[model samples]
Target: MLLPQVLPALVVGVAASLMFLGISFLSEEFQVVLWDDLPDALGIGRYSSLWMITMLTATGIAVGLVVWKAPGHSGPDPASEGLGGAPLAPGLVPSLLLASALGLAGGVSLGPENPIIAANIALAYWLGRKAQPSLPGAAWVALASAATIGALFGTPVAAALVLSEALSSQPGRGSLWDRIFAPLVAAGAGALTTQLLAEPSFDIGLPPLSDPGWGDLLAALVIAPAAAVFGLAACYLFPYVHTAFRRLRHPMLMLPLGGLVLGLLGALGGHLTLFKGLEETKELAASVGGWSSGELAKLAVVKLLALLVAASCGFRGGRIFPAVFIGAAFGLLAQALVPEVHPAVAVSSAVLGVLLATTRQGWISLFIGAALAASPSMLALLCVASLPAWLIVTGRPQLELDHEGKALH
Candidate 1:
């Protein structure tokens, strides 16, 4: 009975993954040119503080022009949207893509998730309607969102967990598994497609936790909530920073100004604190033994600040990836401060806390924390740690903003 829907959903999932990978590849190429090839050709150090400032500033101006002149103003400020907000009209996809690509290439401390998902949703909704006039619009939304989430994390489990939270909140028919069946299929297809092509990975190569103990539990309980508090700090600051940028009243001015500020932050934090933070998180983890507690703390703080400014000042991107980086840095800092704590325990717990605060999505937070630590043994500890952390962030202002510019709860 469901084969028809299932087949189309699978196809949409594959298409969505392809779209994400294609955009990422192009953006990375541009990033290399701006941050690598051009710098080498000009005899300028790519990571030189001055060059960082110049490139970021230039990137800001360029992105601002796109947002100002491109169709649909790049489809609303990202601060006002969540991971699966209303899909944009097809007309706005190009501008959104360009803006996102520019931001990604320009060292914006945000990820491709938001704009890419939005673009995919818009495209899926438009095309799906054309092909299957009888299918509900919500069906297309579910397929596209699931597919994107799967592709983003390189696993269908992420999509399933996220959608479970979302579905439980709404009125639905049939069993939970029954309702989620199609989306899961789509998610599986998307995850498999990305896995085959991009080989995306979340593990940061932290040592595995082969054994669990009371101390590990204690570490998780403390570190997770602490990291959540750190992330909540950003949530509290979101609206104020967003309002400050809005004062500029135009993207061209707002974005460039934001860029200049980000450049200063990059200069302060170095290249490690720049960009979306996925690869950088690995870099930090690989060299975790060498960094002092204070240096790791500074790296986390500066990256959070950069995320705040970039997301606030009209950059089209997502917060999740950067938040992951912040969590990892904090986790590493925790390990540095208390050498007895297993690196896996500290990192997973801290990531759980930060993600809990920033995303307000328990499943996603827990999943990401475990994935990064590459330690299944830490899951039970993370689950318990998440309890207090959830309380700390619950009912508090979220990182996302409403149309009135107030923080969403």
Candidate 2:
């Protein structure tokens, strides 16, 4: 039993590793070309970084074109999908892979989770069928999803917690550990490979939390629900945004127009508010002390709206990366307004609220919030904050949009 678990994990892990490695390589090379080679070779950026805005605009248009014409509709509109899905036929894989590469490289403000998850599932199934034909199709989906998630987050435990909740809700045979054994094996291998390739760290390098005060706890209890309402505001607007864009009824027209509008937003918000926001999150954190409250507020507002536009306009990507960045910005703004509050408490609490409202994954929300400052005390506060935060959005529709441009249930 253990041998079977370990063996499939080894195979699936390698496939996932190679899949993400290729994507990272392509994304980097493409960025170099778009933001570096093309700019330098053309003597652009002489006056300002306005050239970046132009590049992002063009990227939006180009990606829209690919999504419109790509085979298999780029393997499904990301607005309607989650991070994982069933294995696709080999014939429908290429277009998704290409579109994802383009989006990742072109600075389309989306992550590679969806396409990579689907791609890994397809590859894992092909290999699994060759070597172990007895594995159920659902088992392949679980294995691939867990492996890819572990690789992406650089932690096997994330997969474990996520799968634990997911599997508990479904009817299944065997003990929970027995069902998750192979997935954990796959997660561990995948996380190890990803760390070796490139460590996936989301830390903002905040001061460690040693002592969290009562004020901090009270503020967290209050501020976190406020952030949830802030995030839920976008959720309410999501359907309207999607419906407005869908009225164009064609990706070519709708997406390019969205790109142009997004480019204008980038122009107003500057580079810090652009991209999927991993790098920019670090930039924001490092420069938090220097930024004025007004500037931080602008960043929080601009990025929030930009995320809405990008997702509503048919760009392919995941929401978690940008959502975390949004939470960080909101936290910074809170700290700016109230200098007496602890930075770690503010940031982690705001993240807890935003992520809970956005991802609706309680463990991951609290995990990410606490991990920001590496503070156990803050984790306790987020635990308190999350209950009320969960209540605020319990009956609200999710941020995802369906094919008809409506919010999901």
TM-score of each: 0.99, 0.95
Best by lDDT: 1
Report the lDDT tens digits of candidate 1 across residue range 1-409: 4677898889988998999999999999999999999999999999999988998899899999999998888998789999987879999999999999999999999999989889989998999999998888988999999999999899999999999999998998888888788888999999999999999999898889998999999999899989999999999999999999999999989999999999999999999988999999999999867899999999999999999999899999998999989999999999999999998898889888988898898999999998987877888888899999998999999999999999999
Measured with C-alpha atoms, the lDDT of residue 302 in candidate 1 is 97
lDDT per residue for candidate 2 within 146-180, as digits (tens), equals 89888888888888988897889999888999999
Q: Which stretches of candidate 2 lie over 4 Å from their true place?
A: 46-49
TM-score of candidate 2 against the unseen true structure = 0.95
Q: Each prediction's Cα RMSD?
A: 0.8, 1.9
